[model samples]
Target: MNNFYKNYKGIIWLLTGILCGSVAGLALGKKIEVLKPIGDIFLNLLFTAVIPLVFFAISSAIAGLEPGKKLSRIMGVMCLVFLGTVIVAACLTMIAVWLFPVHEQLTGAILTEKVNPQPIGNQITALFTTGEFYELLSRKSMLAMIIFSVIIGFAALRSGEKGTAFTRFLHGGNEVFKQVFIIIMKLGPVGLGAYFAYQVGVFGPQLFGAYARSLGLYYATGAFYFVVIFSVYAFIAGGVKGMQKFWRNNIIPSATAVGTCSSIATIPANMDAAKKIGIPDVIANVTIPLGGTLHKDGSSISSIIKMAVVFALFGKSFNSADVVLLALAMTVLVSVVEGGIPNGGYVGELLFIAAYGFPPEALPPAMIIGTLVDPMATLLNSTGDTVAAMMIARFTEGKGWMENGEYGLESGVTE
Candidate 1:
């Protein structure tokens, strides 16, 4: 029990906080409103470290890439994996919407027109541009950041000795941000407790019922998607034995993410597991951290699924163009920016719904519903990260210092 607690202290504390907050909110009655400010402070602290962390981690990972064919292949495979997951997520979302439609009357109070719509052309322009203009448009700016980072990384790789200084600089920055993240996370229990209490106080326990319904749908769809998609990928990558071996080693991290519902917090364990599975340290370090920032398949899936359900509930069917655009936009957003920010899935879902001129009344329930699915999303996403690391290791096996099975191959694949 001591060892277990030592390993899962964060998750245990988070759960304890939530449980206490829920009870307090129920008992405190009107006083529950006081928790809101405290919760906001916690959120702010968590978010404060995100942008710097993302920029530094991504830059370092890209900079570490070898300049030649190996880098190109890794990038290509990463892109393909990201794109494929996005499509699967979008499709699963559409299916969820069709299966369990949200009733319009239930969300009538949430409908409003508070947000001003941005021009599509402007959004597209911001997506491709650089500098202050891009920063101002946070949602679309990720594409620009990704492009810029790639170019800089490639340049760094080509510079040889000159790049060493820059690489060390970025690596130092990453370590600093990670330390800051740890400091913030230490206060997680307090912050999460306050936030959880405030939510219950504001919305009441009745809201949890709605949250549960949407959550059930999200999980059902997600499970189906995982079984069909990841299973196939695992089989192709390593066969039945490989798939089994991978899951056996990774189950702890996956379960930890699900229980904690925070991918960033699960990084330590995930990194450890990746190493145990025979993935090269450099690849594991680069990919897992980058994946936490960039890969958000589960969040994307839930957001789009919730959006479709909300749209169907309001009797507003999206046209083919809107569907195509939404899918494309979601794919890019999920791939580049979604997981990098705190409460990112919630913010992105609301923004996407508002962008399409959907009714505002749907936002609150959608947000609540989304949280219930967060754990599942986190689990799937963490799994995706580990899977990508394994795949990269497989692809780059022969070229690197660590040959096949030398580092403790779990998949029974002989060198």
Candidate 2:
């Protein structure tokens, strides 16, 4: 039995769960109904893991990055790379949304009786206030926790011997949690299968019908982004040879991202790919970690897709101002603060819900789409990080970056 489990891949199990769960739900959900609790158990486990998983992972990644003088320069280049990708991703999403339009049909969509839209001022105020120390304990306040962790990470670096010990402790904690995450993921088949079964039972065949085309477009655009967009960036950074090296080395990282669906979780794989593609540890360690947190073309692209679909469902038409606002939100706000935890879609979904004053009911469909496409989105995001690392290395460290040849440091990279 153990050997059988060992030989089977996790993705296969997850797919099996989806297939079996959907079948069971359609066939036996009303009769049994008891299976709902089983699915809930898995979801609760996932939620339980989110906070500590995010806190330790982000801080540890930050602590493990190169210290002092090199930090700012690396972070700056990475942010630029992340922002550039996000803009391009946002543009692509807008184009896809325009090309494949969703009709105004909310049948079988998750609905709420009434939604009291919060004022923009109130929402902004609440975001910061809700992230206070006490409020940070709440699941909704992950943004605050992220900010706190980054501060603690930088402080750990400056604290001398004690700081080094603290960083090491966080890194150790991160490793332990990764194992825990794996263990939880092992149950994904049972959990996801049950969950999908319940969804199928409740919504029936219409569940797939509602979001199919929108999801199809999103996925098609994502494939194009990976092949065409990434290749273009690679060429700019390292030319033909560099592009070839990037594609060759990217296989593992991209595959891992699809399986894990978490950029933070994919860090180790991304770093490995970076090394294989000849990016130095100095560049990889800093840029990759920062990218896991900040550079999310995948999430940004998904945000636009979600918003477009949700808006269509709500029967809201986009004007020039609405389009501008969406571009700003997707390219900047949502892209930067997207959480690295699995099922972290709600953070961005909340932003989508509040920013456009969409009825809170619209959130479910948006989050549903985000959840469905998470693996593909994460693949693009994580893959882009490694590619960006290589690009930055070549541009900043010169064509000999692969050879570890020293290039001129920017003003703050050295003492």
Candidate 3:
């Protein structure tokens, strides 16, 4: 009982605040506008801190990789498992939207400025690299920021001995910014509570109607993916016995995913679960940490729903081949390199807007979708990491990886 409260402290408060704010909105209606300023203050803080947090978090993880430390066959197969799972997730979402359309024309779509989109070639180039270093500092150029961070990481890695001090600097900045984010998120219950209240008051019942439809769609899809698709993955990874071990040990990580809503937060539990499941220590170490940032089935699923909502509001046909393909590509891009912090999907949401040339107005409402879907998304995202490690173990370590009470034997140490 004490452990449950300790583990779920963040979500319990946040959910309580959200429920209270919803009741206030239902009671007070548009008068909730008075609370908008409270929400905005927290939002401004989050936006300001996110850029540096992303920069250091991404750069430091890559920079500190010490080349051949664990970068072996596990690394190779790990990338494949991540990509395969995200593709499945993306495809699954596309199918869900087709079967159960969440489309509704948002009245605010008319308020958008005329979008004079740049050429595809220019947009693609700008998607990855900012012409000026200063441009990467803003949230709008998130992909560009990520690319810049990656280059910085590789550059630091190539510098070998001389880069040791620089790597330390990145690591220090990463820890500092993580702590900063923790402090900011401590305000999430109040901020998001007010934000939800304002949204329900202004948007009226559409917050429950259109937005709820979107939420329902994502929840249904996520539940299906979690139960059915993940079971398939577990079966594939180790057959019946392997699947049993996974189900047995996955509780702590799954609970952490819902409670904390952060894949990075769930890593220790995930790694411990992997240890208990008898995954090779080498594979667990490489795959679980790598998956925290790189593998996100939930985001891949949610990204599609987000794009679908944006398109529906704008009266665009999401069934188009090219648009669907672009969404799939973006989600794939999003899933592989997503930041694992709470609300980190904000970066990927921006990418969706820019990639499809959606109006800036699309972001706020879509962010609501991200927030609503976060717990379940984090469930799939974090738990999927542990499942992915098992799959990687299957491929790299071969069949007997789970043979002869192997999973019960504790960590199978393999350098």
lDDT of each: 0.63, 0.70, 0.79
- State model 2's lDDT: 0.70
In the predicted model 2, the residue pairs found to clash are none
Between candidates 1 and 3, the one scoring higher on lDDT is 3
Candidate 2 lDDT, 1-415, residue by residue in tens: 5643543355456667777877887787565357768777866675566567767877887777665455565666776777777888888877777776655334554433444546657655654446347766654555556667788777886776778878899999877876776788778778767766776776576666667877888889999999999999888878898899899988888877766656887899998888788887777877898788778888877888787777665555543564556455545766765554434455566655644555434544665577678778888888899889877886667777766623234334634
Local error of candidate 1 at residue 227 (angstroms):
2.8
Between prediction 1 and prediction 2, the one with superior TM-score is 2
Candidate 1 error regions (>4 Å): 3-7, 69-78, 102-113, 127-147, 231-328, 331-415
**Candidate 1, residues 1-415: lDDT per residue as tens digits?**
6756665576567667777887888788658978867767765664455556556656776777655434444556666776667676777676665667544333532222443445767656655565674472343344565556667667777778977999888778867876786777677677767766765665566544545566677888788766676666665556675577577777788777866667887788788887776676756766788688777778767876676556544555544564557655755564465565445664465456534555434443454456557667888787777777766666656433123544533433322
Query: Worst lDDT window (10 residues) for model 1?
Result: 103-112
Give the best candidate by TM-score.
3
TM-score, candidate number 3:
0.82
lDDT of 3 at 174: 86
Name the Cα RMSD for model 2. 5.4
Every model's Cα RMSD, please? 6.8, 5.4, 4.0
Q: Arrange candidates by TM-score, highest first: which order? A: 3, 2, 1
